[model samples]
Target: MFDSSKRQIGFAPPSIDNECIAAVERVLRSGWITSGPELKAFENDLETYLKSPRVLCFSSWTTACELALRWFGVGPGDDVLIPAMTYAATANIVLHCGARPVMVDIDPIERVVTLEKLQAAWTPQTKAVMPVDLGGWPVDYKAIGNWLNSAPIRERFQATSAVQETFGRPLFISDAAHSFGAHIENMPVGTQADITGFSFHAVKNLTTAEGGALSFSLPSSLDLEQTTAWFRSMSLHGQSKSALEKTQSGTWQYDVVEAGYKCNMTDIQAAIGRSQLRNYPDHLNRRKEIAAQYTKALETVPWCTLPVLKDATRESAYHLFSIRINRFQSAQRDALMARLKEDGIATNVHFIPLPLLSLHRNRGEHMRHYPESEACFNEQLSLPIHLHLDDEDVTWIVERLCYHVGELMTPHA
Candidate 1:
């Protein structure tokens, strides 16, 4: 039923250029494509750009999340709190580490975990709170940090200190896969949480084919350099020297400190990342402009409920332009998507609430427990928002959406 003649707009895709291609070519010709100088340069640039104290590149955000859990010693008896409205990876990492993932509801408008929700879920077994930056919007890091630092929270941690001392004080690990350049209170997402992970997958604003990074905000008592070194070791099969380090003269001798995962980012991937990072500010500006255009174009549509972007102290990276079809049933939502597909305009749902998924449900989570998340999942749709989309593309997608809204709302189809 789809026609190639009608322009096809993808949901999200990488915005590659000659510079990115050249960067990859350079890595390929250097004879050091795996975990070498390019990775080092990329990590340094990322730290400088984000103003974070440390950054550790990885193969994927999921791996980074798992490593963060391991670093915090979250396993077996520990419980980690996560927002119910996030992608599965946010909770999956907890399960990967043998910890329980306690689901909490997000603010309906903001789509982020709130202080009240977090506090209600906090228990003696709760070792960490993971807040997902939904659709590139920065969660209220200040509020969450303040709550964790509060007297009551401190007292709880102190009371359980003997049992949970290894977990290292109710840590805040941010799942910021969509918010690489996002900022809150003049602080970048990288440094906002005690530990934050950023994704650079093909669909993300910063495309690195497939890669991610973890930034740290270690406690005063902990040595930042030592912590980063530990993470570096864990990411490379627990070896004293990485492939890059061993390649140097007289440096071939190394040791394996512990059993660790092979999740280090290669120079080939980092090459693309370095090029993207250099041009990230311009790309981000274009995204912000596109978001503004979409906001203005879709404002008058009664069926649409747009994302809130009025936080004076923070700004999203504008990863996904998600809108809800207000008052629409799940059937109507599906119908709208089908109609859009028939018109050759591609669209997607940002997520289906984790609890509603088969895997999580099989693990004993009920849909009724996350009412708001279910409501959002039933109506939410993601529109295309990438640096490659121009004004014409934005106009075309909005036109199709308005047309489909009318078709679905008619008394009889």
Candidate 2:
């Protein structure tokens, strides 16, 4: 157990300050709330922050992904390729769109979808590739973009939606729920993929308490405003006018365009998101600092393996510090976690690979089929990485972790 001086840590927590509280309070006090001035302002600020063609806010990452797929016209008889090692939301969104999600395995180290895997999984029925930025590290979309544009791959592409038809190619959708502040190819995530979705769940670096975003840079053939009009209508049960617009005197008349889902973000949540966005640069920097401290302390511990934060082209958002224990099985990982918990240090596993879950298993996506993904899942553990951790907390957490892991490696009588 940790010394009495330390407190029990949490794996992920929102960095809520007085300013964040004030932001949300302002929404509550305002007469206009749901998708009102605050949501609009947040979207506008995000537009400038991300420099995207557009940004659409949603209630959750699941809805943002599902809505984006639906917008791209992914439906029955189509296949969307996704990584086997992502949260179920990535594949679940594909299932919701009536498209079969082809479970593609990840590269051994990056634990992200690679062009080689995509090539193996490509089928004539494949209409989109939804590569998740697994844990905050952005995937290499430039290479994937090249592959999708190549004759060998593009020749088989079938346009499923109006947007797909306009592009004349398969969609490059990114399930980037963990990569809110990451960058790839000198571009933010919003520009890297044709469509990128972000999560602002409580555990995320940038939290809305609970919300998501859809940011994109579609081809010129796609009219950004026209598509956004459709998305605005679709997000709010196909309303022709937003709630705020309806508030204008003698302007209540509206129309339902597509029997859409009610997944629009509320002004209250947007207020929180805006506050987080304002602080994101610093929030992200602190996370980087914590990750660096962990690396410095653990790099010499042969049993400890730090996460990869950057490569030649991609840089992680530093959302999760998922360290792997060399040669440790799931049991050892769990034992170590229990030890950490006893020591007042909280930890978590980034994900249980989708293939191993009951839903995927029922769909015939068994873990045995994804040996590489299984290998990754068995050895990973995520430590706390957020604004809440101070210099002392990071040092204490790492010191306890290294000690516990070392003891586990010791020979027993």
Candidate 3:
């Protein structure tokens, strides 16, 4: 019988304390609370943390990245290569731009798209390569950058806009929504890609309540200040000056440059993010400790395949602890999730690859086309890893997980 008095472990809950509450309260008490000083301070903190040249905050990762695609002129007749194993938002943004998202298969173990897979999917219509850092593990940014800049890849370039022409090759925009603190080649994830977008969603490792930011790493030839201004304008309906700027005594007059999207991060949200950022290092360390605990406890299990936390060149953000049960089918995986839930433990899947979604299926994308992604999705299960969980919670969760998995894997009569 399941114990009703036991605590139910959540999948990923935001770590909010008095600091976060006080920060939000301070913002609420301030006279100016929109996109203003707080947001700028938060962006500066991120810029320093990631050691990137520039960073822009937005309402959500979806908005920030979609804006990036638009900036690159990824319109109809263009193809953006992405992995089939990522969330629907990855593909949805491409479709929203009226471009096609050419899905690529992932390495079953790494669960990330490789440069070789991307090379195979390239075409003249390929305008951008937006590979995701699945589960906060970075893709091979160095190799992919080299491949994209190679003579063969560059010679086949098709520039549709001034920004595209300036690059003389396809843009390497990384969907780094899960890799905010992750690193590769002694550099942060944001510095590797031409433009990397990080999610600060409530369920993410860091929460802005609901926000995101983009880190830019374009070539030296472009005017980065102008580029930054343009993105800031676009986020605020293309106004020549921000509402904060317009508040000045005689600076009310401003012009709209172009029709743009309204997705700027609010000062209130930035306050929460700033508070979180202050103690983010400790939060991240705690997550890593929990992941280590889970790995050490479960590695001895015969059927369990633990996730890769670190390698020679890359390290994850410890966003999720996804384990693969060898030979587990989708139905069995679902059953195991249910069994864990019955014990008041919440387990989840990282994603149901784009091919399995109805939106992609209607476009003629088949699950059979991505065998590796299909296999990974079937066996993959994301275990809870959050600040809310302590060592005792991790041990209990692991015990329940192994018990339920063992029961489900037993031979049936």
**lDDT value for candidate 2?**
0.86
lDDT of 3 by residue, 140-216 (tens): 99999999889997899989899988998999999999998898877778988899999999999989989999999
Candidates arranged by TM-score, highest first: 3, 2, 1
Model 1 misses residue 6 by how many Å? 2.7
Per-candidate Cα lDDT values, in order, are: 0.86, 0.86, 0.92
By summed lDDT, the worst window of 10 consecutive residues in model 1 runs over 158-167
Off by over 4 Å in 2: 1-5
Evaluated against the true structure, the overall lDDT of model 1 is 0.86
Q: Would you estimate the TM-scores of all the predictions?
A: 0.96, 0.97, 0.98
Decreasing lDDT order of the candidates: 3, 1, 2
Which residue pairs clash within candidate 1? none
Single out the weakest 10-residue window by summed lDDT for candidate 2.
1-10
Identify the leading candidate in terms of TM-score. Answer: 3
Give the number of the best model, judged by lDDT.
Answer: 3
> In terms of TM-score, how similar is model 2 to the real structure?
0.97
